[model samples]
Target chain A: MKEAAGRRRQSAAASPCAACKLLRRRCVQGCVFAPHFPAEEPRKFACVHKVFGASNVSKLLQEMAEQHRGDAVRSLVFEADARVRDPVYGCVALISSLHRQIQSLQAQLALSQAHILHLRMRRTAAAHLASGDHITSASASSLSLEVDQTARFY
Target chain B: MKEAAGRRRQSAAASPCAACKLLRRRCVQGCVFAPHFPAEEPRKFACVHKVFGASNVSKLLQEMAEQHRGDAVRSLVFEADARVRDPVYGCVALISSLHRQIQSLQAQLALSQAHILHLRMRRTAAAHLASGDHITSASASSLSLEVDQTARFY
Candidate 1:
């Protein structure tokens, strides 16, 4: 027990990487996650581990090539952050909320466009009536008025 | 070989639930998914299975309460539809697109409100300048003009 305690103290003195330290695991030499996830930002790994279990993350990192691991880690971190913030839906909620907003905005855009078109048509008709011009042969003044009104956006 | 063929025919005659059929598994007695997903709507299960794999969905269904299962299935279908439409981001893309739209709409709303406020303030300042009226002693007629302009919203 005394010898084991002494070895543990020595290992502690060496200072494990942030992930292993937070996870309370021994950071062995050639730890795959250490280089990408440093000791300073334990929260990054904490959120990732919380959402996608540490083992799964380990498996994913192990499966990917060295060149791709960095990007994979970044994507995982972003998704994990979204997941942690909204537990039930995680990133999905963000996506759904955004979808709803798009629907509403699209509706609003349609309405605004329709209103603009209606206003333009009404102005054209009124110009024709005021000038007493026929349907096919609208006066140049009425045409110019139509252009001016349509061009005047708000 | 004849006996195996007979057994396969027997199983096929039973007609598995949509979920089981899509997954190419036998729909045994008391399948949790059977009641919610009938055999007729194979496409429903196909989309759901395509977006969220069978095992994860099964696990999720198993974890939820019996009462909540129906609604959960419905939401899953909606999300799966969105996912299938946008494979790369799945539902996340819909959310992101909506979020971007919401941001833009919110910005537009703010601008419109600001413009209305600025217009009101200018009108008020002009009225004050024209009539030499004190801030608190403004007439009801001036306020009525503000209301009329705002009410003229198309």
Candidate 2:
């Protein structure tokens, strides 16, 4: 144990951590040694590292997907340096980007919803205005056969 | 103009900003006065003046809200000199705090989402193993009820 400690002292193993490894520095030991982190480290670093863990990349990705909608990917890339190379960084980065893409799709869905609502509102207004005619030529012209294509997503 | 520039050099009353007004200090013109800023004395004054112009408070509030979920507030407050009672510094500090608070909330929300997913996965595994009629019994439990609640959110 003494000899191993001496070796560890002489040369810290290159931590696979993307941030520490990218910087080519000794790993101050990864998240295990990072208890001084979330509990005691000042608010800024604590908040960042608490959500982002070395061994817990899957959790981080899950959080990114469910909450920030993929903003975490850009942050993860920025967080990585020479000393940190956990392959999970790449996986999570991909996940974050995918999450962002999903969010973009969601935004599109929302706009489409609002548009449909608007069309319904207009139909109601038109019906109020016209006592007899159920189908107006102006409204019929606005209706696109594209509804069949878009409806597949629902 | 030269005499006025020399004589009017920053009176206690004509000081550039509201912060300077309260602090009773000279508004040392910052980067906003240089190459990007206008050269004429009135225009030079306008640069700093613009910052405190119409809707400044609302703009500051918006910026604060954007950063409210992050540590920006604490850091900004820490940067302010406690010795001074300047509104400029106070406003900046307050906005920073708001930003930090927003970030902390965002992080917490993200964590909650990840935890919900984890719980869902756990229940799914448990359900898969629970045989036959026992599945109905397990489904009646609180964990399954929580899953039903979570399902509504997604």
Top model number, lDDT: 1
Instruction: Output the number of the DockQ-best candidate.
Output: 1
Q: TM-score winner among the candidates?
A: 1
Give the per-residue Cα lDDT of candidate 2 at A14.
35
Question: In candidate 1 chain A, where is summed lDDT lowest over 10 consecutive residues?
Answer: A111-120
- Candidate 2's displacement at residue A134, Å, is 5.7
Candidate 1 has a TM-score of 0.49
Task: List per-candidate RMSD values in Å.
Answer: 9.6, 19.2
The local lDDT score (0 to 100) that residue A86 gets in candidate 2 is: 24
Model 2 chain B lowest lDDT segment of ten: B74-83
Query: For model 2, what is the alpha-carbon lDDT of residue A127?
Result: 49
lDDT of candidate 1 over A1-154, digit per residue (tens): 9999999878655777778887899888878788778877889998877655677567667766788777667766766687567434556656566667667776666545544554546556655676787776456576566656655544
